[model samples]
Target: MKCKILPPKGLYHPVLPYKQLTSDNTHKLLFGLCRTCMNKISFKCKHIDDPTLNKHDKIHEIKRCKECKNIKNEKCIHSDEERVIVGTWSTIEIDKAIEKGYELQKIYELEHFEKTSTDIFKLYVDTFMKYKQEASGCKCDPKYCKNDCKNDKECKTKIQYIIDNTAYDLDIDKVKYNSGLRFIAKICLNNLWGHFGMRDNFTQKNIVLLLEHITKIVFNEKYKDISTMILDENIVLTEYKEKEEYSKPNPSVNVYIALFTTAHARLKLYELLDILQERVLYMDTDSCIYNDDGSEACKK
Candidate 1:
């Protein structure tokens, strides 16, 4: 029930016109000011540190200052109200949310279920279709291939055409001889997703699962206790930033790559990576060791 709020008990009256002052049943002081002044003075005079709300425990168990979030301050104060608004996770509604969470992932059922027999095909498809396979592509098979087809007139003509087009029309490829790292692969994904939290309609739940999947593939490989193999190998996670003094507003991507490296690398690499996810983007990885200045290379 909405309590009839009166002036805060034991407090003095407000000076000039402010928003309609409402005191809770307990008469805790409610404060507001004109929007114009609120906008102007908020950065300086807004009492962000509410003493009572500061001491109160939060629902998500998230340990953060309430005012850290400029927008959600009021909505986040439910627990501070004379009566807390309990959601499905509260005494009344928790069971329902849990039941829904376990009702089976809707997307999985819709896409993978078979109609013929009531048997769910999820386990088989997941095991076979997604069981990690070697990442393979056509690398110029240097050692063994002597394809007779390469001698064919049509094939030779086609290859000549490509070479001529590159030499005369287009500038020959600059990145073909070496791997072209995406200045920041990891950060790129994060920024593009953060713009509005993904172009593909993904709920927060989908995001959590996506992260879990990527983390598993990255850190927990199928190789059993081959821990020593990874230990011997050098791993590096990199995030790129273009400027030194002033930086892109999105620096969080660099931090994400650093965190990922820490999780996957046997050697401690935390000192090398710096930046927060809110600021940077992710780039790529290189499997090698180099001198501090990078003039000398340590082959991986």
Candidate 2:
């Protein structure tokens, strides 16, 4: 429910005027923004910061806050000398931060007019549920199962056909015991979201039989990261990614589904982090390590 109906669709960059972009209920994401610089200082010049101070200019040519950039402010007032830029965050993050009293401005944002279609993950979720029930009590044969089977079920032969194939390595073993049927079912449930997030531009391969074609490709500014290999005197293999204007989105990929899936997962993680707070020892995208200290937060 969180992943589907909550994620907005057809987001706009730089956001439409007064459309009221807010992640109040729809989405959640990690936010890191400048708090001290918020509404503290106003700039008087067009040059906000010295360019020479930016050692890694390639990563960011402009080292000023979006607020400063918006008003063409010349001076930066951030306390941290190394951190000249105010930094950017995703739309959801910005909205949540704003609510938290971080007076950051958004020069661009992901804004949508409508919510995501509920049917995006409905097929996969339904299939996962169905197979999860079927494989709930199923176990593996000792001779066929590669992992240590707990032998929790009597209906081993029901999914024997699936057990005969390769055992999939899914990391949900701690939640539920692994069996071929469950593994097969897990792959079906988990793998498809990644495909929807496939990169829009990938290195395209071209075989050149003539010098004229190779020269033409080399001179084209639309192509980037070009690499060429000489197969023979007349044959050449060229590979390159296209610039944004020349690149096309893959027909099968929908980035909204992928981003939404991750946003919901992060929301769940943030809930735990809020509970654990100072007790959190380490954390990653999918896992967290914390010291409960008899707080009873993890008991549920």
Candidate 3:
């Protein structure tokens, strides 16, 4: 009788060398084999751990396995894994948070200004807002309005009231103090109107899309889908444009303006500090830690 030859363990059937297949093809083949072995052995191999691969990779692997396994008596591995869930805030809640933040900044500003005996600083802010509202013809209550009134050219005269009353000539300290106060106030006055405008009866689908768009932007991917969704020519974009033309508060424009003002204030503060030769170690929206030597110089 002729001697019978047997294949090695785990290779009873013909197998291709890994180098013969492309990386993707090899991954699919190994993934299918791993799944079959896992089902029979009731465990996974360390080399083909699920956690090591990302969701997309895992999905692709499983999909390939299902397609290939149909041709043979191989078992298909299916995962009941779900995508990550994100929490969202209501527009009302967001508005409340913004208001609370502004109030906190105001309180801090008041305390600091009062400590420095700069009552005129508070008066200047009040006067600026008063003129600003008058110039803009914004009917919103001054207490709640996040709109900056100083952007109006008509508010220049009002600003002159501040300059005239607060001596820039008699004291360089007063000038620097007022400059710092103006920047801090600018930061406090900012609001997220663009995000606010997008607020509708947000369903789960809409939130998911918004989150996806934000992720795309963060990852530096082309986000035209989300952009078009936001500026849909048929409905939202056209309607918003018409409303804006009528001098209505455009949420998009408001958001851009707020951002610009905040940036301008930050740069202006840095410039003022540079002029005073003060080294700012750390800074945030409303406050900063500068060289303590000239700390009292810009108290207001």
Each model's C-alpha lDDT? 0.28, 0.54, 0.35
Candidate number achieving the greatest TM-score relative to the actual structure: 2
Return the candidate ranking by lDDT, descending.
Answer: 2, 3, 1
Q: What is the lDDT of residue 53 in candidate 1?
A: 50
Off by over 4 Å in 1: 1-71, 74-76, 79-119, 130-132, 135-300
Residues 1-300, model 1: lDDT tens digits: 111111222112111112322222221122222222222223322433445454344322233434545443433222213321211111111222223231111221111224334225345423322211101111234531224323555534543454464322221221122222222433443344254322321212111234455354445433222111122234323222222233334433443333323333312221122212112233233332323432222111
Lowest summed lDDT across 10 adjacent residues in model 3 is found at 102-111
Q: Which pairs clash in the backbone of model 3? A: none
lDDT of 1: 0.28
Candidate 2 overall Cα lDDT vs. reference? 0.54
lDDT of 3 by residue, 1-300 (tens): 111111122322111111123323432222112222323322222333478889789767765564345434554343312111111222232233333231111111111123423243355556554333333322234442234534545444444455565433222112222334454545443333234334332222232245555454435432122322454433322111122223334234433233334444545454444444435566555566766664545553
Model 2: how far residue 53 lies from native, Å: 27
Superior by TM-score: candidate 1 or candidate 2: 2
What is the overall TM-score of model 2 with all chains considered together?
Answer: 0.52
Q: What 10-residue stretch in candidate 2 is worst by lDDT? A: 1-10
Q: Candidate 3: what lDDT?
A: 0.35
Which stretches of candidate 3 lie above 4 Å from their native place?
1-255, 276-278, 294-300
